[model samples]
Target: MDFLERIKARKSCLKACETTVTTVSGHSYMEKILADGTSVISWPQASTSPGYVIDTKPDLQVAHVLPGLCMGSQDVAHDFGLLKNHSVTHILSLGVKPVTLDQMLNYTYVQLLDLPETNLISSLDQCFIFIDNARQSGGCVFVHCNAGISRSASVVIAYLMRKESMNYQQALMHLKNIRPVIKPNPGFVQQLKDYEKMIFTLDGK
Candidate 1:
């Protein structure tokens, strides 16, 4: 099926599923429970579009993944004061756009969908370049998506695996240690596994 067809099918599936409001850590969000017992978290407001699942409460927490790398939700990305405080000189927006463009910070926007089937591997090379450029320039990069739970998390995990010479599990565990809330979709997890294999192959390891 084509992309649009797949999106239509997903929307139909979501519409047919049972959704409930659930609270965790004092934050409320919609959870769509599928027939297979898989639950997908969604935004508080009604929207089935990809990248729309944001926390109801403003998430200002930014986890410092590395010396010059940080991960956060769009809320923190949009907050000028928070970004300034973090000394963020570059912003990597995944699957979401900033409210306004800030001239002071370098921006790299990647068009990604918060879906299992979304192809993040193809975009990783460019993302790595953008991130490394900021770090090499004595600047920090803030990576974020709608909620910093899926797309952005996957990118950071892939970055760690490649840059730090770690395996998928090692990268994930290290990231989870710093940001426990990150949970990449199943497809992204598999892709990261595939990426690990590819990396080893290219290195002849």
Candidate 2:
């Protein structure tokens, strides 16, 4: 199916979204502003796990895309305490900015110059290596761009496709299932489909 068709089919999966944050008390918390301009807070984490699942509207600041993985904006990248709280062992910067938190702690840092219009297939292999290494070490990797919707999300969806043996549709569906607001650009979406075809051809599928 084409990108637009896929989007139309999956639109219903995204609704009633909010930004999720975990409190020091080990509860999932989110603050929302209603249409009437009233602030409402909710704590839904009656339990916790090694990796907390965040289900809410896509906030560029941070969204837990999957277990052992997250995608966020540059604001999240600069927040040392947030990274530490989430036990993020690696940071993948998918923008031109030099990662400032790399030397602040012992975290592994990988930077790639990926623009919204840039084709990402060439960098997938290298990026995959860093992400895989972090996961194997029982650590999580946070991928981010200026905005989490396009560049960073594209890199992450590519990783899931290549590493997890999922096709573009499946990987994207899974991503949106977790983080509802991810919408990669059309060019990136096409590149992912191309990458999917390449993987299938290599596997003789």
Candidate 3:
């Protein structure tokens, strides 16, 4: 990167690096937010077995899209704790049923809307509402289903496009930084491109 870009990147990195000082023999874990302003979910493991850590940048508000069963109690709790550091105050699950605090911490959101299905259009419409509320409240939000993939990424890109003025490529790259495998399904990716085109047509860009 250019010198100025490097400097700016470093500054953001510093801001996102909120390290946990305390350590527990087994429970303690350290996290540092990515330059995109999302948390890197890490837990140290024993020498015998190593596991992958979630190093995500919740640059913009986030979403999760998965089957109803994926957001179980344990995973919900994990996401809830990471939410604090990522500034994720509002949780939006695209699944039909809401994720209860049996595992994740309780969040007092204005409302949680469960849609009919995981179509691109449905995801976009829900994103509109969350983006509106989040902007008004000045709080971070999240969208998830099971694994943080296709549906999550699609809604996230919509939020970026409508709110952050990110073009398709830039928005996709940003999501990649947060979750490298954030590959929205082929059909969904096409829809996002179409959304970009719709904006371009309106703006004559």
List the global CA lDDT of all models. Answer: 0.88, 0.73, 0.56
lDDT (C-alpha) at residue 91 in model 2: 83
The clash numbers for all candidates, in the given order, read: 0, 2, 11
Backbone clashes counted, model 1: 0
Question: On TM-score, who's better, 1 or 3?
Answer: 1
lDDT of prediction 2: 0.73
Tell me each candidate's TM-score.
0.73, 0.64, 0.52
lDDT of 3: 0.56
Candidate 2's clash total is 2
For model 2, the stretches where C-alpha displacement exceeds 4 angstroms are: 1-61, 102-117
lDDT of 1 by residue, 125-201 (tens): 99999999999999999999998899999999999989988999999999899888899999999999999999989
Q: Residues 1-205, candidate 3: write the lDDT tens digits.
A: 9999997787776655657533333354678887776688676653332333544544333323211111111144344455665555556665434556433332322222222233576447655676566546766555564455666667777777766788999888876775676777777777788889987788788
Ordered from best to worst TM-score, the candidate numbers read 1, 2, 3
Q: After superposition, how far is residue 194 of candidate 2 from its true place, in Å?
A: 0.5
Instruction: Compare candidates 1 and 2 on lDDT and give the better one.
Output: 1
